[model samples]
Target: MSAKTKYTDEPIGPVKVIPDFLPPPEELVFKEDTVKVTIALSRESVEFFKREARKHDTQYQKMIRRLLDAYAVAHSKAKQNEITAKRPARRR
Candidate 1:
């Protein structure tokens, strides 16, 4: 058995008040524009996502969507860089 905690009435030194740094309730709820699509994926891939999702306690479809979104974002930035690199410098 553990010893019981003792309560003290001692003053806890100077305290600073911090402003609210969190967003409002409405802003806390994120709403993303999404579209429904039907596509066939390999059984192995689907199973993999399902297993991972179950382990993380989240929806498998969300994991797949986030993966695809991340891939698209990364590739898009790389494509933009390639395009900029190919552009000739102005003879100002």
Candidate 2:
């Protein structure tokens, strides 16, 4: 049997009060506008995602979705920049 911890009344020196760094309950839950689509993918791509998802301990479909979302966001930003760069400067 293990020995019980002894009770002590000694004050802990230099206690620091830490602020709450956690997000609120509403923010904690992520809600995204998603739509279901039926599409076919190459066997090799699906297999690759599945293998990676197994190694990372996450769902394969989720990994694929995140990858597509990131790709879309990156391309959207790039397209916006391209358009802005192509525009002529306005004269005062």
| Candidate 2 lDDT, 6-86, residue by residue in tens | 989998799889754444679537976889999899999999999999999999998888778767877797899999999
Per-residue lDDT over 1-92 for candidate 1, one digit per residue giving the tens place of the 0 to 100 score: 99999989999999999754444678537875889999999999999999999999999998898788767867797899999999999798
Worst 10 residues of 1 by lDDT: 19-28
**Clash pairs for candidate 1:** none
Question: What TM-score do all the candidates reach, one by one?
Answer: 0.66, 0.64
List ranges where model 1 is wrong by over 4 Å.
1-29
Every candidate's lDDT: 0.86, 0.85
Clashes of 2: 0
Question: Which candidate leads the pack in lDDT?
Answer: 1
